[model samples]
Target: MRQWLKGLALFVAITCLVWVGVLWYWQATSRDMSPEDIALYLGLLPLVVFGLALLARWALRSAVASAVAKEAAAAQAPASGSPALPSAGQQERHAPFKLLASGLSCAAGHSAREVADALKEGAPRPAPDKALRDDEGLPVLCARIEPLDTAALQEAWDGVCAVAQADLQGAEAQPVAVDEAVQRALAALQAPLQQCLSQLAAWSERFAKPDADGPQAASAAVPAGLRVFTAWPTHWSPAERAVAQAWVKHCLKQDSADWLAPSQLRLMPSTQGGGVALWLEADRALRAAQREGLPEVVLLLSCQSDLSDARLGHLQREAALFTHTMPKAGVAAESAVALALADETWPELPDAAAAPVLLHRAAVIQRDKPIDAAGRVSAQVAEQVVQQAAAAAELPLAEVSALVSDADQHSPRGAELFSVLVSQLAQLDAAEDTLVAGTLWGRTGPTAPLMLVALAAHRAEMNQQPCLALSVDDSVARMALVLRPPAAAGAEPTKTAS
Candidate 1:
């Protein structure tokens, strides 16, 4: 229509110019022209002028109409609290929550291709990835309201979609108004919108800096392991991001107890199920911070100490032969052994009366330096043993240091006791049926410094070595040693076997 109007205007202007020129030329050159000529020229001049005037008027009217149309468009635009255009594209960006505030009046879903077609207030059918099922597998269609006035919302939404595409295409240079689009999309997703809003808000809060400011600014949720201040890096490299994401996902799948320091994560062979498996991830945020310009990389394994007596014992034994066995497999075995000890039931032992002889044997060792009596090791010794354990396993030195340090804090005495006990424990290699004993007696009572000596001999079971018996009592206190020999030929062994 505009093009036609422009062409008509051009034709009119050209015709007027030609008529004026011809009339002027006749006036100048045809001086002796008759009355008819004069009348004709005069008559034609006014008509040409009239045609020019009409064209000018037409142009003016066209401009006025364009101005009025623009004003009307401005007036029709939706404002605050206005019913949003129903298309998925009309909904706001960050402000979908605001549209959702009033609650969606209507939602719809068609096939996969038509998914965003005409959603209204109710939940739509399951998407391609999902299956909405009754007994049989079929597309389940649902809506929150009945007899939907679909035209207004869908048509409004179609306009919204066009606008949204334009906005997204130039997001960097020109952003679209987010309010209408957000409302439309969320209204389409009415059922989960509120829940999604809460989650999104929480995630934003988690990632956003308190001081940062911007439009379209985003703060994606940090992984769960990173929730703690010390656990996550403030500035992460791309590699670190990948590793952290993988580890966090794995941790989330397991029981909470499996979660631990990132350094402690290891590829150790499992004793329970089968081959090797990854342990918990250790923290590397500190390391990353220290190496500012370096690419962030996770230390694959970190050695850690087990404070439990049983765990420490297993670790010590494993360390002795780690090189011979699969280092990874051995470390895994030791770790599993430690975990088992932690999970073991602390069932009450028999009373001293029920097994006096066994109790006597136990008491001999128990009456040592109060620390040693509990089968605990010393901090100094544990540190050394942990170092040895880490070296044997070929772990990073820093990791070993951490393990030893942790051991010192958790069980300061276990290591020293282990050191003392291991040697004496070896001496009773010959005895089985008969018991053995070791003493560390002080004058007034059990002393800070104690010694363990073993004595045991076995005649049966093909000459099994002697069992260890130790005592650490005060010199002033009377020390008595007794051994219950094996019952002759299966007489129901009186004392519980050690």
Candidate 2:
């Protein structure tokens, strides 16, 4: 094609030169030419100029076509196999850095099996030289797996959390050191979650879509557990119950388990009273009646919200007389057999207020804004609202505090005697220590003699007899109460209530 175009250009150039020479010769003798011939030559000059321009264009085009062909041939000779991917030798050349990336990716996975396989048999590193450097200055291939897509990884981390919760309930795990074991397992499970979260963020950026704000928030939070609680005005409906169960199944590996069954859940009336409701729900009703008259109770409850020291005392006072058929157990116990039972026959008590919110110190809601993204809560809001509700129903702050302090020092078993002593000892600096001793009798400080006396008083009350030997040491601000079991009593009940 190039040769043909060059030939055409040469022919046209030659023809134009010949015509120009002939015109010059003719003009030399044109003094005798006719007017009509002059007119004809003028008209033909335009055609000649156009032919010359065309010939020049053709020549340039031919040269370019030849040069491009030669260059293409040279490039092809080098090889273009499989898009010119590096040969094994070329790949080996990059192995030092590439191998490092593979090693790092394997380490990120942290599975012994995966790391073992990678060490034994090499793995694929990502393509492109540019991705070889990341924050660590170490080669970082784009080998990261998107966390949202890594269902297996999420499942593993979530499984650990389920095991921890089960350990608390004494189902899947033995409760030897229940609280400590749970804390350890939870910490271990959350370590890998950082990687999972990083991957999820990457995925969010990759497939970002309009109107994905809600989903983005959900992904960002990455709730720790099965997300059992729900917000108010959005109580657990039939559909929601089903979804919750399904979530439990997926994240907790618990399917058709009685704990997750919807039928097992009861819709009892909401409890009122900062911890008072919990004691009532715990069957301290009979105890309450024995101490203080059943003071027009509004609700029978199994849960409490605020856990301040004051609230705890109020709960204890109410629980002193509360009565029920449900079996009782200590809140903190080591043996699974001695701990609260996990059966339908077992009585349900309100769970303690959750550990303080640790993610963000305080919540802020801008008044002018339609929504407060920073303060808005999904599952936790309900618990707090319930707690605040109970707080609102309580006595004034001063009364609540005094009552709580008194209750802590003395068990409900003998509230009258403890309250009297607390009132009498209010003037002493050792009052605080005494209260602390009564609240935590077995666990008292060495320097607090007054606290030791308070513990003895508690023990005396438990024995249910006059404690005449008891004496209060005015020098050290200490008081002691002593008692013996009733002579006629055959056997004391192993269970005791505060």
Candidate 3:
């Protein structure tokens, strides 16, 4: 404070003196009214301008530097008896979650084993009804599925949840608002949040979003793990948006948990699943539950379909209505996948299910460059995410068993994935047996994350090795997850004679 004030005072004094001197000289020169005086006065004007520029720069520099320093110091300091910051060497988190079991359902398969078989046999179906377009505006096939209206969503959810051991109860629901459930959940956690909320809000906007209704007392309805979340389209009409919000809540009643969604869920041309996965990992890191043995569970999902029932017939009209021409360059397909993940704490998983795969690491990063080239990862941020994951997992890039990737040649995500591979994993070739789940499963909408994670787990099981899952969202948000197969079991004890 003292230094800044001194700087400001010095700046003001010098500037005022210089301006006064210039005015006086100008008055004197004008009074003389001679040819030399005119030349001298003009010359003095240039000198005056230079003096002022130098003066301003010198004075402001100190003040600005002091201000910036103050802000940085404040940011680093614990505020009003806040928790002390973690030390630099504290790299490992206290609570490390394991994957105990997983459940998956997609067009490719209903179970992890089935998905693995389909990928092994290369049974991906062809794009139907001109789902995508080439750069030349010609038709480019994508892995499309049958219609994905409300009925399809319900049917797929029913089948997938059944396999996942999730039971839905209550009467059938109308397409009404479900915002109240979300609000109540947030309210329930508000007290714990008030303790460390300032810290948590840095990563999740959920805490930062205004609760204009102050807060109601904690509701017994909200559960700890369940996060009621959704990402509705911004261009949607009020009715359309309401249905989307309600869909998530209605779905939550099916599972009976708090709903949480990442901002990435709302609108993105590609990689919605990856984006949400990244946020989910971040939230996990911030959780107060640092219990090692409790483990963690994740449900990841994605879906994409034509804007409406008439999408196939009115492609041209749809293209004209939107400012961007994604309908021209990108494919419109329908897919929905559900994956249930758990860590070692839940060891009672069915023996017949695929062996549990460990999630070694997860990362979400915001890049300086926003993806404009349609699914390209020219941004350096994506490479850093992969490198960080490998380093954190203590796993070498060369040992990657398989890739659960979003960069398929037939899909929009294909543009930048090659760049990521060449830059990050020098050990693997781009043509290596990478599983592009979206391309193979018809580009499931928001459910893509769960589907890919499930696929990664399957790959880990089939090859008895680990795999890397990577995707770039809107070219800026880079999401990555690494899965490792459990270590081989030791020889069973010799049987003793009874």
Candidate 4:
């Protein structure tokens, strides 16, 4: 009301000034006219000036409104020949998944704690690759993991082979031959997968033990069924994927068979952003499991490694996509991340040592244009996804304490993310709160998205605040979700020991 009154007063003052100027001009031009004629002209001037001012204001408002409507329609429109996404109502129907545990392996470190510590210190700088060079004869920069131990990888492979042999013996099939390429891929994935399973096993054991607090405390039994979802890069062949699946089954049977049984093993392969897709699949599976009254734990795992000369050479050859310029070109990197997710109704959830972080349903939207299309980069799609995800989680944008993304140093990706942060999540300090996994780990291929999720979960748990994870690596789509820390209990939330 105050603002409206102020605008009215200003309008009136401008109208009065215009009327006085017109009356003076009339008087100067009509020196022969009577005083009565001058008085009538002055009396009519105020009404005419007021009418013109109102008309101009209406025209200006109409123009502004029309422009806004056109911009909104363009933003919501899909690209030519692109399929329509699900309605917001349909997306909101998805239930939140409980994050029981997480595992990570990257150039910074092998364990989640180690990786988080390294990230906290500062942004990582990529070193020049000794084997790969760009068009300018300069070495390409990359963030490569340290070399793995040959003896241990071989030992693990032998066990997998032994398991494969036993299964084929009954069918009189030939022994599976080991390929060098398969070995290298398997080695890249081994560390994080093993670490994830070990942690899950330990958690299961703890949950099964009777509570020491009192008899009234619930003594929860471990779930009998397990569902594993694994994602590999598109560059890997079918044979390699089959072997990787077999290896995972063997590991579970050998280590977890006493308390858990594998019921389903799904393989998801994609050129990029496979980790985000894997999580979405897991959420769907959980909903189906609930409908069928099945109690099961789901494991989401993914890994990617581009440390080889062949791989780096391929990237270097793509001049349009990659260059030697820092913060403009992508750096070759490798990483692995695993997440153990379960329904909120799991029997042992309440008795767990730490409160589980909740993964709200993700919102994925198609871009109106391709990332490489000739034109200005647009942040509309990215902004829409983030807003939708936050809305689905019922979280206000101001409450999101940090932003984590798989966007590399590429200008388009960086610009898109920066726009979202500045416009939507202005509450966060970009330098102190934003974590770019790609800059730290380089382009980790399929593993980058999951790595972002893992890092967000860790940060949320530590700070007891919500963190947003964004997947902007895909060229055609953008995805975002909220990782919210559990609500505060009477005492403060426990922090992870350093």
Candidate 5:
């Protein structure tokens, strides 16, 4: 009200000054003019001009009001049969998955704890690649993982080959040989996969009977019906994908306390939607397992590396997608992330000591427009997914403590994500409450979404509050999910796992 009054007073003062100036000009220029001519030129003309200005201001206000009303109505309307805002009871019917453990191998660090710490310290920065350059003869910036020990990877590869050969002994199948490139990719994935499976094995051992005699007894105590969902790069060939799948299965068998046999393994390889899609599939698989009375433990894993010169050169040639400018272009990166998800109802799960981090059902939707198009990109899809995720968790947007996203410095992606955050979570401080994974890990390819999830889980556990994880790196789809933590803990937790 005070501001409005001040504006009105300023307008009146300006109008009075204009009228006085006109009157003085009329008198000075035409001293011989009649009084009637003076009144018509000075009084009436000024009055008419003031009235027109007022009329224009009113018209502009009305148009703005109308647009606001239309946008509000559209936001209230459901985009599909599943309402954007579900009631608490409706949300409760959809059970959330418990995030038992997570592992990460990225430019930042080798474990979830290390990665989280590195993020806190801002350790990983996009640096110029020594071997890759853009069209302008400038080095391309990238977040690169340090090269692994070749001898160790080779030893692991030999074991994997032995396991594969033994498993296929009598199946009347031809031998599968993976190319050097695929083997390199598999080697990149080995660290995170081993770390995640080892964590799960350790967790299971915690609940093993005190009287259990040996390692076999602890292995027997490990949960059955384990499922593995792996997301690979779309560029991998059919043979490469098959070999990668075999490698993942063998890794699981080797790390899973000897309880997860090759015959009992259920491996699903996904080449699209990255880690977000894997989480969605894991959710569905958990629900199906519940219905069939199977164990609900599942592992979601993904890895991608663009550190190679060939990959970087290809990105440079694709000028439309990448550029020499750091802020506008997507930075090439290498990363691997693995998450262990389990149903809370699983008898083998030690409920008392489990970290209270729940991954709510993810909401995913496709954007109607291309990401790189000019003009304002509507935040409707992104907003809807966020609302749906919060609703599924039975939590209000206001209660969300932090937001983690895969949005980079690229304008379109950042704009879309910022629009949603500003509109839906008005209480959040942009600088303090938001974390962008791309800033730290660059563009992590298929590993991005899960990496965000792992980070969100870690943040929630540390803050003892809910954190939102958003995946907007996809060209046509937006994904969101909420991670809820316990209301209280003795101190800040170091990792997402129990």
Candidate 6:
């Protein structure tokens, strides 16, 4: 009987353990995922795995090919047929430098001073009906450039180019050692883009409805206006095609640029390919300035009239960002901002008209958790970025006389941003004034940070004191830059572009 009882007890213990395990699993699953979700995961898992595997295979193949090529080149170099190494002078390089001159084209104002003044005194208010309140009951507004069409873009491009050209004399004229590979890539990309536009122009004649003039005029028009319904039959959308066509045309217009040089460094706007092409030629000019041993200037400009269509102000379906009645996380405004950089190696010019703007220091850091995530923003990364910038500038936080940021004052993100800034302010030398660039220019898209840079440059020139520019990108990187008047002067300006 005792042996039978022991066996029963053993079975009961085993049964209890099994039940406990099942209960624990169910509890976990209650919070997230169900049988339906399981099926969805199962369907997606294969694609994800396949993508990862494909990437790995490509990387392995590339690495192996590179290794084999390097071996072959090494083996060939000792032979009689191998070419000799190029001389140092034949290989060109450039270091970072400060801005000698700056130009801005923004909807906020024609120049940085106007934009700064307007930003401080308060920009004109948007129509009450146009503003949307976000999930947190904060209003978001946007500033736009009047007429978001090609003419506006071309004009803005011309204005910025003129500024850069005037300040960076001979930058486009500066000789560059052509990189054959880069030239080939540029040509390859440009050729396809041109062809795409030409095709669109041709197809446009067939699909477009007759306008006031006649059907014949449609041939001159690009396929971008065929309407989404009409353009859907084609592989790509009209909107995408229009952006590409505009970019390619813009590139071809920059005749002053050395076409053979490598593509220049560009600060990409907020999204993947979000008009990064807009700065392609400008990148070339900036590179030329670097090659010519000239002071570096960064120009950040944007006009957002194009974004007024949704009038929702760059809204997304975040639960907390929208209310049943309104969306408040965005603003509409225009802005033009500029900055002059100062490299430690370059001497500051004496007898300067005003203390030239100098980039005292800058820092960027990735957040542990994205600020845009569902959780409360830690802002630790932002604080670290600022601290690093201050440390590099050798200035205390108290000395940050002014603050410029792309964040609007009305969103939850804005509230978190201000909270972070306030916590940091207690550690600063003097309380700094805040300028929400977006509040003045509306959400300027990628121009948000550019506007901040421009504003800092303006304040540095005006107060002859340091200004701090802070910004966060969709990539979860927080950046802080300190702009101040040039500490000293150097040599005469180099040959500049007309």
Model 1 has a clash total of: 54
Tens digits of per-residue lDDT for model 1, 63-167 = 999999998877777543464444422111101000000111221211111111221121342122122221234322211222223243344444444444453
Q: Indicate the TM-score of model 3.
A: 0.52
Where model 3 places Cα greater than 4 Å from the true spot, the runs are 1-96, 100-123, 130-142, 146-282, 291-302, 307-328, 342-355, 374-379, 410-412, 429-432, 442-445, 488-498
Can you write out model 5's per-residue Cα lDDT over 55-88, one digit (the tens) per residue?
A: 9888999999999999988887756344556454
Clash tally, candidates in order: 54, 12, 28, 0, 0, 46
Q: Estimate each model's TM-score.
A: 0.15, 0.17, 0.52, 0.70, 0.71, 0.48
The candidate with the higher TM-score, 2 or 3, is 3
lDDT of 6 at 90: 29
Q: Once superposed on the true structure, which residue ranges of model 4 sit more than 4 Å away at CA?
A: 1-94, 131-138, 156-182, 203-223, 262-273, 325-327, 349-351, 488-498
Evaluate model 6: give its TM-score: 0.48
Decoy 5 TM-score against native: 0.71
Against the hidden true structure, what lDDT does model 1 obtain?
0.26
The Cα local distance difference test for each model comes to 0.26, 0.27, 0.47, 0.70, 0.72, 0.47
Q: Tens digit of lDDT per residue, candidate 3, span 1-498?
A: 997787667656655666677669768877655677555655565566556767888899999999999999888775656556554234333112354334434446655677667766777554433534433455544444332123433444333333223222324343322232122222222221222222222223222333446564243222123222233222233443333334443443333222333431221122223435434753463242333332233433333344333443343454421113453233443344433334334344343344456675476677776554434346377778787766655567787766777544543356567666666666665545576654456434344555566677767766777688876533346677777766521122211211
Model 6 alpha-carbon drift over 4 Å, by segment: 1-97, 105-107, 128-141, 146-328, 332-352, 427-432, 473-475, 488-498
Residues 271-317 of candidate 6: C-alpha lDDT, one tens digit per residue = 23222222323344455554665533333222232232233423444
Give per-residue lDDT, candidate 5, residue 281. Answer: 84
Residue ranges of candidate 1 with Cα displaced over 4 Å: 1-206, 209-287, 290-498
